[model samples]
Target: MAVCLQLTTSNSSMCLCQTFTTHLFLPILYSAMFLTGLAGNVLSLWIFMAKISGKSPTHIYLINLGISNLLLCITMPFIAVYYALGTSWSSRSLMCRLAINVLTPVLHTNIGVGMIILAWLALSRCATLVQHSHGPRPSKCIKILPKVFFSRLRQTPFALGVCMGTWAIVATASIPSVVVYSMKETEVVEDGDKQTCYSVAVEVGGSGSQAFAVIGIVIFFLCLLVVLCAYMAVIRHFYRSRKSTVISDRQRVYARVFRNIVVIQIVLVVCLLPYHIYKAIFINLAQTDSGGNGTECHSLSTYVEIKNVLLCLAALRCSTDPIMYFLLDKTFKKHTLNLIRGRSNTQDSHSSRTECGQSAPYNNSSPKGAATHDTHSHSKD
Candidate 1:
């Protein structure tokens, strides 16, 4: 009787939570994120393509990241609809499958590509700084490492290879999730009224979901550790160099670059970490409590609510990444400003030309006649 009562209460809370999230909270959040992310990423793409002729490895990685984020943004409305409609959605099973498969793989792909590219970016930035530094006295082997590895990476073909490899590896790893996820009617908030698209592994009531969550957490931490170490090495190099009496312009430029890289990484962590941490805990507890293992449903409801909110927060990363580009990359900022300025200038020039033609059509079409008229008037005078 106690278990029954607890289950009932949990169900009621779940319904309320779902209603709130689907009706008001998520639509506003998703819409804002989608629009902002789309605009920022589109602008980023334009700058990368039009304003920049030569592409560095870091730039290439950033472009790829922008593309990934744009793809993620494109899927936001589909996700919003899924949550908002609950199980009442009348979409075909194929639409449900397409939405699940496309969204899940893209999310994983975004994370995978971002992590790999960021690590590469740090390495590439450090290599450039070391190459340009005047007071660097590393041993031959140590110095040669960046040249042999990262210098080659700066080449366009090599960067393309890296991007392609990243896509291939991430897609291969994400295939399992794509295959396992299916659309099923779940009785979480209603009597067979609420349909959910979820992983088959999740439905089997085993440790699979928990195991996957642990693996994801481990991968996330591993990449984060790599990024931190790489940036720390860069920072330490600059810090030690500060002891020198005279710092060159090159070193100052490196310092600015390092600051930008640090800010970008900080943004990345702030946007994504909470979601992963909360997800790991939620999966662990939810899986443990799946088989009537003496857990209160109220606590489970709270976990569900927390996880949903965190997931929404994770979506904010897409919007924040372009902001990072604007703040960090001087070239990107300059180009973006120029692009905006150029567009306005073109419009102004076009409007002036149009008005001039309308007001004095003969100025352009009959220059000889105007000159002849002036000559005749001079003769008359």
Candidate 2:
């Protein structure tokens, strides 16, 4: 009878938790995240393609990053809907598994690729600075590394290769979870009066899953550290340089880009830390067989709630990325202005000619011949 009472209480608590999460928190959080991520990522994609498409090699990498984030954001609505419908996978089991599995790899690859690209951009800028300090001429050795790596990168189709490689890694990592956790039909009975179908089951985490999660966390932290280091180097370089060099338009633009990147990195670290810590702790707790269930269960519940909130914050990164691109990239702004203006090449040329005509006389005429030369110079010049 005592065991039965304990089981009943556990069930009640779980039901209450589920109701609170599904009805109250999940709907609001998921909807907001989905909409924000979708709008941000889509805008980022448009801005990159429309404005920064032909700017530089570095912009190519950034455009790809935006594309990856856009793809990930597109998946958010499905996730939101699933949670909003009481955490039940109403979609086909295959889709649920595939979506979950794909999401992990896409996220992992996106961060990895973004960090790698950002590092290259920083390194490229640093190399340019060093070369400029030396002289206008670039040494043969200085040119070799970029030529070799970029040539190789160009030869290999990066987008297709990255997509395939990422999917493979994610699929391989998710295999254990797929095998260990089979969807089981569960009926929640409330007050002996209400019943609803839900998918629930026990998932046994194997060495592989644990290892994958650990490696992912390590990759994330390593990238964060590298980016921080690179930013510090950049800051130092800016400060040490002459004020005139630092205040140039090019330098200012790069500074804004660096600032945005730093903000994004900080957000990434803050949002991901709680999730990683919770995962580590929860995994350890699950492996222990202590029958002191109540305390463990409560702790798990709290961690889960915290994890959900952190996940929402992490999702916000997708939406904010586009805004960063818009704010930081002057080329994007110029392109947008051009598109809005929709002036033809002919019209631009005509305007240029008119402005030149207005200024030509003032430039050509001497003080004594000002009036007389003005009329003649306008026709001749």
Candidate 3:
């Protein structure tokens, strides 16, 4: 859900960038995210692993996503501490080493992994919604759509494999760049500076690191495109299946799915897109203008500060993810409410299928079911 924030470099005389955002803003924002994201992710993970009975493909993917969110939350305090202390730590200290070696890698790994997970989740949802559609009998084109995207995305085993694969791929993509930057480059900073985290060595990285960053930007856009297309396809499918003269449980199911698509896409666009887009531009600028090299704080001017601000926005996803899960997943909502109401939901957990439904529960529902928010609105695929 969130990210690593670097302080502005120490050459304020060369540029107009504020010197205090790392001190005044990052610590506060990361602290708020830590408190909120930690509680939300812990609760979500519990519900997904323990409370939900029918572990649909969506729930399986969500479990992995929750793990990423939790990891990001775990890194927040160290980031907050680094910023609040004015971004200074003894270069030889344990905290400084951990910040450089552990925190940076973990934060980045989870951010890439989170984006990949979201893309897969969107595709899975699209597949399941189409597979379970029951409004009007689907046309020939509708019948073939699931196969084109992924027919087995709804299967728990396949979904698990896909999630594991996502983590492996994203983690692999992130490691080389981080290793090059953190090890080969970071130690070459000025001798007397107190900088440990935010320095030319840390920000600029090796020239080869730029190539890897380009790879990352390409991957990010591809994933974003997948999310947009799959969610849009589901929305279009719902439209084609509905009739003007009659409204059925199928239509209601379609309506709910549409609302979900809107919410999920909005979250992706708002939280993640800007950073990836700007990262591409930053890389382009750094490469084309040799005089304005990333290796010098004076040359970079305000670019590094802008980069950190956008990264902070991307990290805001951590807090928003749990809220999104609660709003989007029916099974998640039910368990959370039971906990809030002080009711033991052990009985319900075993009896009901998760929101990622396996049954055609929506097919036979009464039209009046739309008026009530019962768990029986024909659950999604």
Model 2: per-residue Cα lDDT over 1-381, one tens digit each: 000101233333332134465445665776676677677666556655543322333445556666666666766665565455433442244445554446544554554555445444444444333333322244443455565543333222543354455546654765554443332222123454322212222122345555656666676566566656655654555444424343354454345545655665565577655666666665666456333445313223344455555656656666666665555544444444554689675654554445335433222224323322222221110
Output the better candidate (1/3) by lDDT: 3
Ranking by lDDT: 3, 1, 2
Report the error of model 1 at residue 366, Å: 57
Cα error of candidate 2 at position 352, Å: 17
Off-target runs (Cα >4 Å) in candidate 3 are 1-18, 90-92, 134-149, 189-196, 288-297, 345-381
The positional error of residue 296 in candidate 3, measured at the CA in angstroms, is: 11
In the range 1-381, model 1's lDDT, one tens digit per residue, is 111111133334222224365445776788788999999999988767655544545568778888888988898877677555534442335555565557656766676677676666666555544433334454242454655775564456777788888888877876654454432222123343333332122222235434655676787777777777766765666665555526354345545656676676777688778878877777767666543323533335445556667777877887888887776655566566756676675654454344334322113245343333222111100
- Per-residue lDDT for 137 in model 3? 56
Q: Write the per-residue lDDT of candidate 3 for residues 8-111, one digit (tens) a residue.
A: 34542222123566566888899999999999999989987987655667777888989999999999998888656523555556776777778878887888
**After superposition, candidate 2 runs with Cα above 4 Å error:** 1-16, 19-23, 50-55, 86-207, 243-258, 289-292, 295-299, 336-381
How well does each candidate superpose onto the true structure, as a TM-score? 0.75, 0.63, 0.82
